[model samples]
Target chain A: MRPAAAPKAIVALSAAVAAPVHAHLVETGFGAFYDGIAHVAVTPADLIVVVALALLAGQRGTRAARYAVFALPVAWLAGGMIGARWPSAAALPLLTTLSFALAGALVALNAKVRDVGVAALAITAGVLHGLVNGATMAPAGAGALALGGAVSAIFFLTAILSAEVTALPVGWPRIVVRVAGSWIAATGLLMLGWLARSAP
Target chain B: MKTQMKRWKQYAALGAAMLVLAPATALAHREAGQAAGFLSGLAHPVSGLDHVVAMIAVGLWGAVLGPPAIWVLPVAFPVVMALGGLMGLLGFPLPGVEIGIAVSAIVLGAMVLAQLRPPLWVAAALVAFFAIFHGHAHGRELPEGTSALLYSLGFVIATGLLHLVGILLGEAHRWSAGRQTVRAAGGGVALAGLFFLWRAVA
Candidate 1:
């Protein structure tokens, strides 16, 4: 009896240990939307580009800035929809990084562009970013996740742009913005190097 | 003057809260039930000293580098880390994973201690490369039935929060004495890395 009881206890322990681990923050329902937002929010690469572009747009004046505010989300959603239809390309990361680097450099140099140019830049950024978002989205509820990503992007871009626009034109603030742009360029170059080194 | 002092006090309290909440062990455990997804993902990074140290070091290095680096390093880390996680999930093999992880602590800590501000891109590359090792560890150890998406979200958020803490601490650089304190923290991290390296090699 004692020997049989020992085996039963061991079996129970093994069974307990074998139970599947839980991993999702939200396992069902609207959790998917939260998951989508979480995905975008956690992605530093995307956020930086969005902020950098917004800053550049704001610097260009109200029209480019307003266009950015509208164009980015629309382009992002369209890009996501397109990405859902096509396989993710290896070049996408490179393109995104380059876009970021370019944006950063423009900001650093305080370069001015036509409003159309800024709009194009915003659109390109949106599409690239949206494509990445779409690629990661679960197929079953891709739309919900995309909506979340759009919402986050819009909110983030608006807040940053508004702050930049409202802040008084102080010497140090301008310097900080330029410094941020330089940093973006440097980071982008580094990523490109890493990509080059790791490429097969 | 009173308000300034109060602000300092608030920051101090927040720091205290951070220290109190900081996880103590470096062992990963699989959660058995409903607590698994986000909680488990969040636990993964803080559970391991190597992960925590390297991550905090990234933030510290970022702060030291200033401006864009403060943002770039943190951002690049997670995106590249996700790629690494995907590779792990696909069963791709990366050699010297443990060594790479231990070395991350040593290298990142040393960067902080020496105040090595490389070109921003170079720094970002360094942070991104090491992130893969950490992400792989998280991915490989993902529980049997958890949603990979949620788990990824949890860990990313957890990792970002840790970076934020390091960034806040790195803000000590604004003052003269605070710079030394931040560097001292870096030294402590480096020494801990050495210990981890020894344990790994042994």
Candidate 2:
């Protein structure tokens, strides 16, 4: 058992290092690079929430729950693509609405689950979303990419934390997801309002 | 015991009938350029307190009506709504549609809570009427082509799911509390509609 486990640890370490390189694939310009750094500096609270979701995602295996687990990353990927394409203030609400609605749909679809695989996928997807966003924030060129890599790692850890907390289902988990969803909707609304003003 | 069970059955049937019979009412208008997916998935219920309440109320009523109502009422809503949406997209008018949508919530909520028992066709007719407004709002605001279809699909799916959720909640509180909670929610929705009306007209 010890001999077998040793290689597992080594492999895990190797894969972990490789993950960051693959994660921070987005390129940034000089203008937005500083803004990314500023956002990182100012928003410690966002980081905390990301961490919490990750921990919660670590637990649970219900189909809707699992889809919700993946929602953020899916939103992130989609958002990044949209953001890349538009790169204008006017596009933010559209992106936000698109992201959140997608998340809600994924969460609503109650599917049957097999086992741990669901949990694992949910955790991966959740972290991927945070990392992708964080990467986008990094400074232009090499600096931006490097900072994004670091943020992605932090995001991954946070996802683990979210999954961990979510594991402990005290009686009802669906209700929790609904409650969480309500909050997500509220946040989306606020973002929508801000985007509307900013664009006009 | 059989008589008591039958009485309970009758009450259940009445509850179900009211949802189907709710007078035509509508709520929450969709905007032009809105995505079909977003309109159907998110906006339908979220746009107004009344829509949220009535949609769920319809579902709960169906559950009380029995298994057939469970599927039938929800199915009826989307199908009717789609037709209405098409009319709107085609530039056909649903007069006083906004008001109708709001009233749908107010009247349906009261009916369900008050346990009003109308004849079956009357109930179906009312729901069908309101569904037009709901569907028109959906179709009127849609973009051209695939997006519109997707948006309509989203709303229909969301509406169906809302009904399912209402049923589950109603089942959960099989006792009086769940039913009452729904009733209270209905009242609140009506009150909010009054506020919305004031805002719209004033």
What CA root-mean-square deviation does each model show from the true structure? Answer: 18.4, 27.3
* CA-based DockQ, model 1: 0.04
- TM-score, candidate 2, is 0.39
Chain B global fold similarity (TM-score) for predicted model 2 against the true chain B? 0.69
The runs of at least 3 residues in candidate 1 whose Cα sits more than 4 Å from the true structure, single-residue gaps closed, are A1-200, B1-35
lDDT string for model 2 (A33-130, tens) is 44444443333223323433343343343442444445544544444443333434222324434344333323323223334544444444334433
Q: Which docking band does candidate 2 fall into?
A: incorrect
Per-candidate DockQ values are 0.04, 0.01
Tens digits of per-residue lDDT for model 1, B1-202:
9976776576566556554555443322212232465577678879998888888988888898898788777766765665676566556788877778888888988888888889988998888899888867764455566533345446766777688788888889889898898898888888888888888889
Output the lDDT of residue A135, model 2: 36
For candidate 1, the TM-score is 0.49
- Writing each residue's lDDT as its tens digit, candidate 2 over B1-202 gives 9976776576556555554555443321212233544455556555656566667867666555554454556656655665675566555767877777777776666666665556555666777787777666643453343233235445555666676787776564466877677666656656766765566556
Give model 2 RMSD, 1 decimal: 27.3
